[model samples]
Target: MDKFIDLHVHSTASDGTCTPAELVKLAHKTGLLAIALTDHDSVDGIEEALMAADRFQLELIPGTEFSTEYHGKEIHVVGLYIDYKNKALTDQLRQFRDFRDHRNEKMVLRLQEEGFSITYNDLLKTFPDCVLTRAHIARYLSDTKQVSSISEVFDKYIGDGCRCYVDRPKVTPMDAVSLIHQAGGTAFLAHPCLYKMNRRELTAMLDELAGAGLDGIEAVYSCNQGSDEKDFKALAEHYHMIISGGSDFHGTNKPYIKLGTGKGNLKIPYRILENIKTYHQKEK
Candidate 1:
């Protein structure tokens, strides 16, 4: 492909180390045609990204990764080409931030009770741009030497069902898709393989999401196995959905993953996005 785009990326607005401006500069220097700032549960960075994208002459897709749930398991729904200023989407994101803040407070308290020195305010100050995720908290813990690494923090405390883990109020995947569509964005399932569900379970979730007007799936990802792209593409074809791809870049958080080219070998052609626009236009 002559050009490439990374449809999923994070900024310090949510769990990533790079600021929005820095991410845009890096994408430009790395020779990417475009990148989507799909920060976790937040679009606070989109404005800065847009400004920098303009200066660098690169496309910046304003997006967010919505945290949703199905049968109590957390699922991420990515919204691409979003209008971050849309009141409905911003209002809902505010609500999500509030819920997550409550959950983060509870989590911090639980950790403090277990003799950790971390506090909720520390996390807020540390991750000032947007809503704080466990990834942010993990970095705090890791930086403090309470944990050797972020991975260790999750393994011992905040991974799902861990003692320090607290569940946020659940937003269904279907509801997420609706909100994305309401905001005039395309909704996609992000990194399905990471969900670790069997084919039957995955299909059922897709069916559920499709019923709510989900437009596509993240068929290509930074961590795809040798055959994963082929398998995921076939799955998307089965559901008549467009295929999206990304590096899921988290800056230093996932240091090995790169923008546009994920984990060194993942390449997402510009046409994938063209295809998305084409598919949605026909639907309209």
Candidate 2:
């Protein structure tokens, strides 16, 4: 495999199996040049990742993956090269965590009422330090014979319109992009193809996001097919946006996905790192 950097990864601070420091070590062993611990909606892992980066002499980019809403569908925006210590970002994450806790409680109740009999306690035990997500619940169900696998759990129980599916409050896409920019970060759409939008719809969304101050898009993703990658690359160029890529690593929750890299199906341009270096050089 060609040497590369992974821009999207997670740690136990959110939903990944590895800790932040462990993730950095894994990146080093895997021969990655640089990596970003873009945990979901939190920067708690950044400090630890930073420590590991220093020890291993690896370049670490502080980042986060935020969840937002657009047209009633979930939109994930990735903020790279961020100031993890920014107070406003931390405060907003606090609010998001609070909401997530409540949402998890509701989901547990719904699952119990639907004859699953799984308690919130069981989920918490499985994810003591990490945020409780539907993914965690799915894992629990799969482990206990309630479901065959994580994907099956989502498909039959907790997925959209499934027995335990519930809507939670989400930040608006515009607001999310603005927050990242305000924190001195570049905001990009993560896995735009996963939204399953058609060409016209994708174009419309890209336009709207550009207007909202989005700076880039994930042109290379782990699960993106060859045609999808081409389309996203073209889209990024058409919008004059930065092209980024990542494996969307989640440790055990997604054992198939690895740390600090995507699957063998991507070609992340090295220019993305050069662009970021240039931007920071100019700022300095």
Candidate 3:
């Protein structure tokens, strides 16, 4: 009954449970008008997702979530409607994968040092043919009885400031925006409220990013509170940035919120898609 567009979802190519094709089918069944596979640091799902889109008549946006550093914090930049075949984009993502692999290895070593016996090979077995992520590591911990739940893994080891946390290489926000632009996409700030910054800090960060050619912001997201969503929508309007929203689905890796749930309160206006369409047309 609801016509929606879920712009920030993952598949097996990243940390989600479904394959690209299966996820597309699910979206069609759920009445999503369009869907973007904004997998973290990878566009591996784009090709299959596009094919599935053709089958289901769903609009597909090639997307990836890149990690960027700003003011000592990690922020995510989601590039939408990208040319996945762009050599520059592919090359940069490959480099990011390499960095991620290195970080995963370091995380395993850190966990080992903390007396957890998980190995990289053991972790790889969990998601063959998919990008490895912290979610995968957390799942491994939970599955093997190393931890009781994924949240435990995060609280004890993988979360920010945890004992086994390892920093990965990140691009500056400016460079990330530039890369997304070069790849023929618009860079949007993903899940701004997750940064947990106060009003002054969040506004300052948004202003800084908007000045750096950031084209949009996630005005609605799963984790945002009512006030937070209203504030972000106002910010988007004031700054003339396109509004973006998503379910932030990660399969069973997240238990409470399912795909397209949007924390049960978020609704993205169809006008956002019209805005994106208009912007693309003008670029042509």
Candidate 4:
């Protein structure tokens, strides 16, 4: 069997439903040789994941997914093989968590103003000990039958440009790239297709990020079509950036995306991890 690796995943330390230990067990059961816990704006799960990796003899890369913005669109940047103990990185992530907490509170207030009977306290009760994300809010709305589906909640509220949407503070793309470098990691644009940018626009953005120290682009992703993967691979080649991929697994928070195989057809080779490490070594 071909060894596989999932470079983007999440655990309960963030919005994902699985704990770090549980995720590790799942990875082992799923036959993943390596997996990175690239939780949103937090490395709190890294130590626990590291312990689990050691126990299972699985490769675990310490990573984080940063929330960034450009042209008012939310862009995500993933930092792979980061030094999770780096003080500057940890301090900034702590600030991000604080901002997320405040943003969640604001969203709750906005929902209440829109005549929804929800509160930040209710969210905490619903998703105890995990980051209060829009996904959590959507789940609450769906579970209560206030929304027919999770997508419906985003369409009617909470999503960007929706009535109850409260934008979270974001770092610039350049700043996000720099933070990854400061943490001794490779920065890659996460899921370029999700930006909803056309070909020329996305290329322009990638050119800017490439100049800002971006090392790769996510050419293979759970949500990407085959044509999108081909286009992204071409873009990566055009910019001389490494190609990277991931399942972007968030456990039950994103039920369709599996750990190693996303949507049942995704297969990211272990060589992608080796390629990244090879580049990191050369950068040193």
lDDT of each: 0.89, 0.84, 0.86, 0.90
In order of appearance, the predictions have TM-scores of 0.96, 0.94, 0.95, 0.96
Using lDDT, rank the candidates from best to worst: 4, 1, 3, 2
lDDT tens digits by residue: candidate 4, 1-284 = 79999998999888798999999999999999999999999998899999999999999999999999998888999999899999999999989989999988988898888888888888889888776789989889888887689888889898889998888789988899999999999999999989989988898898899889899998889999759999999999999999889999988878999998999999999898899999999986
| Candidate 3 structure quality by residue, lDDT tens digits, 245-267 | 88888777776666676667656
Task: List, residue by residue over 35-98, the lDDT tens digit for candidate 2.
Answer: 8889998898899899999999998999999999889789999998888888888899889999
The weakest ten consecutive residues by lDDT in model 1 span 275-284
Question: What RMSD value applies to candidate 4?
Answer: 1.4
The candidate that achieves the highest lDDT relative to the unseen native structure = 4
Give the better candidate number (1 or 3) by TM-score: 1
Q: Number of clashing residue pairs in every model? A: 0, 1, 0, 0
Q: Write the per-residue lDDT of candidate 1 for residues 1-284, one digit (tens) a residue.
A: 49988999999888889999999999999999989999988999999999999999998888999988998678999998878999999999999889988999999999999899998889878777666889988889988898789899899999999999998786899999998988889999999989888889999999988889999999999888777789889989988889999999998888898777878988889999889878767765
Q: Candidate 1: where are CA atoms >4 Å away?
A: none
Q: How accurate is candidate 3 locally (lDDT)?
A: 0.86
Model 2 worst lDDT window (10 residues): 260-269
